[model samples]
Target: MQITTEVVSGLERRLNVTVPAQRVKSQYDARLKRVAKTAKINGFRPGKVPLSRIQAEYGQGIQQDVINDLVRDTVFEAIEQEKIQAVGMPNIESVDVNDAGLTYKALVEVYPVVTVNSFDGLTVERQISTVNDADVDTMVDNLRKQRQSFAVKDGASADGDQVTFDFEGSIDGELFDGGAAKDFKLVLGSNKMIPGFEAGIVGMKAGEEKVIDVTFPADYQAENLAGKLAQFKINVSQVETAQLPEVDAQFLQLFGIDLAPNEGGIEKLKADVRKNMEREVKSSLRNQLKQQAFDAVLAANEIEVPKAMIAEETTRQRKLMLQQFAQQFGGAQQFDESMLPDELFRDKAERSVKLGVLISKVIADANLQVDQDRVKAMIAETAESYEDPSEVIEYYTNDKQQRAQVEAVVLEDQVVDHILAGAKVTEVTVDYQELLKRNQQQQG
Candidate 1:
């Protein structure tokens, strides 16, 4: 066998391989012999068919199979011999079977070499936040609101009030589907309806009747009603004001807290809430820092990402997106994979692949390995959210894939820490609310 490689372009290698005719002949003859042992024909018994007849019947088919197997086997052998780190599967450009030999050309994309000088000059801001008394008080108030009750008020509906009413809507004097409801409870300012529908319900008193004119937005999901003006005839039945529950034993019991010998009532609850909030704040801060570190490393490194890798990642991302759509909209079988265009994921996939390459290089250079203690800690932290933390931990510990996934995350964090160790870092203090708001905005 003889192999040769040519650099077709960036990260792409065109490999030409030639297998000896004798090798092909030997494998073909062996396969023919195996087939002939059990060969059955109209007039010949098993194991009695002539070689010429068998060749005449199955020669081309057997030859094609042999060539395909040889091509599949030899391409990898040639790649290994050339010391190429191929990304995705290779595309066979051409194949020839002649007197000279069995020759084939394979086009493949190889992984690029990544280099980083130093992370000492890179700068990133780390957000610092503390959950103060006011923040805890606000959280407690929000919790109270979660368990709030409402009582019917004999007055006009107002913002933050829940109104129960019956309404019939029509467009251009003709009623449409889903344009009417009875005894529907709507919160004023909730924006559950069209822009003006909720506002129109405000100021309405029980037993009062009115017609509200609302224009659907131009980009409404319902094409027939988009940009159309509709009139809703509504009859208000009730208005209710929110009533929050007092901080008492009942409220504490609601959160699974009991006034035992050592457990304090509201104070213990507040402390637990504060602890959870602190955990969450630390998690959010760590996520932000990791993202910043990754972005910094990505910006500092210049590497040519393999197109094949990007394409593969794009395909994976597209499938994942389609899966999410299926889960959100219906079952997996309900949607077609072709509905999502590949271009939708190209940019994200490219960036992800580029960063992955850079991170891998950093990990190799720094000799960063997945820390078992950190993996266990992460698993424990994750399990803290579950009712049975021990069960969750056991599940992860027993499942190899789950444990590996956690290890990968821990390894990535190690890389991030390595980057932060050398990178110039600046701490930026932010209020808890401001940090949360900024995080939400970035996510959005």
Candidate 2:
């Protein structure tokens, strides 16, 4: 076998591999010989089929199979001999078969050589947060409000109140699409409607009738209604006041806490809420730190990323997004592919590929290994939230793939930690809500 390499621009390589004709003939003849033993025909008995008959019946197929196997084997051999760090699957450009040899060309992308700079002066800010009693109180109250009940009241609607009404919206004395609905129900402060629409519902009494004038914002989704003045003729049919459930025995029971058996059930529930909040705070903080670490590392280390890698990552991100949309859209068969273009994910894909390369390089340079203890801790933390956490832990412990997933996470965390240790780190104390808000605003 003979191999030649070509540089198809940055990170892309073309391998022109040629296998000697004798090798191809030998492989083909061997495969054909194996088939002649049990080759059956209309008249010949099994194991008694003639070689000429077998050759006539299976010559093309055997030759094709041999070529396929030889192509794969010789390509890998060429890659190994050339010491190429190929990325994704190589593309077979052309294959030729003749008396001289079996010649084939493969297009492959190699991993770029990346060098990570020292993190001695790199600045990374780590957020420090803790769940306070007030935060716990707010969380419990929000949970109660989520399960809140409402009753029809003989009064005007107010914020947190639900009102059912009939409304007909018109723009300049002309109705438009989606301009009218009968017996529509809305929460007075839900912001489900345009800015002024919900505000107009406030202080509306049951069985009342009124006309509300609202101006659509310039950025309204509907082009025709954007920045236009509209009037809604509303007939209020019912007004219901929101009532949050008390944090008593029944309310505690909703959270799987039986207050009858426990004397301090409410307090215990508060502790549980605080524990969950603490877990959230820890996870969020770690995510923020990891993101910062990744950004710092990427910025400090400059490397030209492989376009093929970015394309692969982009394809992966697109697939994941489509899966999410499928779940969201009620399993609609056949999606409109045009809705999500490659450009939408190109930036993220490039960033991801760059970070992955940088991280892998650091792992190699530092000779970092996955911490089994950290993996166990991470798995335990994940199982903490599930009922029968022992079973959850057992599942992860028994499943190699699942545990390997956890191990990967731990290894990544270790990489970030190693970078943070070498970098100039500053701790920033932020309000619990403010930290969460910042985390939510951050893009991957």
* Top-TM-score structure, candidate number: 1
Q: Count the backbone clashes (under 3 Å) in each candidate.
A: 0, 0
lDDT score, residue 58, model 2?
Answer: 97
Q: Name the regions of candidate 1 deviating beyond 4 angstroms.
A: 165-184, 191-200, 207-236, 318-331, 372-402, 442-444
lDDT of 1 by residue, 63-169 (tens): 89899999999999999999999988999999999886899999999889778769988998898999998898889998998787889898888998889999999
Model 1 — TM-score against the truth?
0.86
lDDT of 2 by residue, 1-444 (tens): 889899998889999999999999999888988998778788988888888889999999998999999998899899999999998888899999987789999999898988789999799999899889999999999999899999999978899999999999999899888989988989887778998898888999999999999999999878988999999999999999999999987888888888765546988899899999999899889888999999999888878887778889999998888888899986736676577899999999999999988999999999999898988899899999999999999999999999999999899999999999999999999999897777666742
Q: How displaced is residue 398 in candidate 2, in Å?
A: 2.7
Cα RMSD to the true fold for all candidates: 3.3, 4.2
Model 1: colliding residue pairs: none
**Cα error of candidate 2 at position 160, Å:** 1.1
- lDDT per model vs. reference: 0.90, 0.90
